[model samples]
Target: MKLYVNNNLLLDNITIAESLKIRLVGLLNKKSLNENEGLLLKNCSLIHCFFMKFTIEAVYLSKDMKVLYKETVKPWRIGKLVKNCTHVLELPEGMTTGIGIGDNIILEGEKNGKGQ
Candidate 1:
């Protein structure tokens, strides 16, 4: 799937990591993330880069798809806890420049034509 912000294709390739195993492993052991690729961790509020090799941009979103918080996390760092966040979008650093707090994020191929 893809992630779109404000009707613009932000991440062309998106992987939804909803399962416990997938979410636990996350991007760990991965060498790098493509410019247009990202991972969405469903039912997550915090993340840790303990075993990651590279930095990443983390965007916290509410259940309604509103961006609640965003931050750039370096390797071996920990992300802040976001209240009421239902999922977390992990992307390459600087890819979230245009996205901001309270922005609505849309996921392609959804029945509602928007993220849930």
Candidate 2:
């Protein structure tokens, strides 16, 4: 899959199966994450899991790759749909610097008809 932030390509042809094995420390030090220090995206879910903590940031996205809604949730927190979200992207703390509401995130992957 490919990840684009504000139309800027970040990761091209990234296979989540392999990327999933990335540890927290390496993810935190990754530079090309477009302000997002860490990412845990699979299929359509973006989960930023803090192994040392109890918090996770979840952002649901639409089919067109727009952020439908976002939530900073803990383990006990429940998730709800604020919009028609088909995907989700999670980021580490303080990683959403230049991003905001209505921002469009373009994702090209096998699931979205863009085969790798």
Candidate 2 per-residue lDDT over residues 6-111, each given as its tens digit? 8877546433332333422323334333442334343444444333344445567777667667776554345565556665565544445545667787666653
Candidate 1 collision pairs: none
Q: Quick one: best TM-score, which candidate?
A: 1
Question: Over 4 Å off in model 1, which ranges?
Answer: 110-116
Give the per-residue lDDT digits (tens) of candidate 1, residues 10-108: 877888886677788889959999998888888888899998999999999999889999999999999999999999999999899999899999998
lDDT of each model, Cα atoms only?
A: 0.87, 0.51
lDDT, candidate 1, at 88: 92
Predicted structure 2: lDDT: 0.51
* Runs of candidate 2 exceeding 4 Å displacement: 9-52, 108-116
Model 1 backbone overlap count: 0
